[model samples]
Target: MRGPSAWSVADRELMAAFVSKVNGSAFCIGAHSATAERAYQDGAKVRAVLTDLDSAPVAEGLRATLRMLGTLTGAGTVSADDMREVLSAGVTRDQIGDALAVCAAFDTTNRLADAFGFESPGPGGFEAGADHLLKRGYR
Candidate 1:
């Protein structure tokens, strides 16, 4: 999740969590959601997005991007019209590219996590993992 990009670390983690939520991977969702909540220093935004995007209290660009990412994860591909929708919502080409990269990586990671039967470590472990990732990242 650590990279030079327009999205902050918290945003990227949220994207990962959203992707996992779409893929129905609870382990990935809980882990990344906790990381995102910790990085953002609040859970409200994360909870809102996880609950519903239409009124998620995030920027237009982010909502559009996340919607597109969610569609891609569910549909396995996004149409050019989807790209246009995101662009029309004010997400730049560079920003969409960055978000797409995160989506692609997490799509694979989330699938792998399911395939490997990864289990949730509960709240405390998720918090510790989040803290470690916030401090050191995924390297």
Candidate 2:
């Protein structure tokens, strides 16, 4: 699994959480929720972003990046110009790549989990993974 880099771990978890929510994968959503909460001091911020990305209080660049990810998830295409626009917004290349990677990975994972009929184990399912992520620091 890809780990968070220079970007806030909270942001990475939020991305996973958002993708899981979009895919309606209860397992992933629960897991990511716990991971996010464990990784960030401001867990509520992650929840807020997961709840309504547009209204989430995050940096303008990150918000734009999330919007880009949403478009990619829905449309399956991101123009070169669109890439340039995001890059110009001060988003590093690695950050963009990592976000895209997380989005793509969750897309596949969500499908598999749902196709296999896996259900979320409720709120605490994230504990195991959260332990590892938390030990690694908040990023």
Candidate 3:
């Protein structure tokens, strides 16, 4: 999540949550989604993005980045046209790289969770974890 990219912390975290959801990691989805909600100030908004990307209430640039991230998560490759779309939508190369970094990191986290069979927390655990993360910082 460390980046000087134009994407906001909320947007980046939402992208991470989306990637986690795509990877079928409930724990990650919860953790990142709660953080995103804290930053964005709307849990429903994050959930909307999680459930559907096309109509999510986010900037076009962020939507484009999320699309590229989705492509990376699902297909393991980003097409030239996909890159073009994101770039054309005003997402900088740095932002794209940052998004890819989040995607890559979460992909590994998801696998590790599955490999070790990490148990997902209860309904309220995500919010608590988000609070802790915000207080302590990701570093």
- lDDT by residue (1-139, candidate 1, tens digit) is 6878888999999999999999999989999999999999989999999999999988898999999999999998999999999999988898898999999999999989999999899999999999999999888
> Would you give me the overall lDDT of model 1?
0.93
lDDT of 3 by residue, 14-111 (tens): 88799998899888888899999998889989988988999988888888988888888998999999999999999888888888888998899888
Q: Cα lDDT of model 3 overall?
A: 0.86
Rank the models by lDDT, top first.
1, 3, 2
For model 2, give the 10-residue run with minimal summed lDDT: 1-10
lDDT, residue 77, model 3: 91
Runs in model 3 lying further than 4 Å from the true structure? none
Give a tens-digit lDDT track for model 2, residues 16-68. Answer: 77878877788888888788777776777778877887798788778878778
Where does candidate 3 have its weakest 10-residue lDDT segment? 1-10
Off by over 4 Å in 1: none
Poorly placed runs, candidate 2 (over 4 Å): 1-4, 136-139
Say which prediction, candidate 1 or candidate 2, comes out ahead on lDDT. Answer: 1
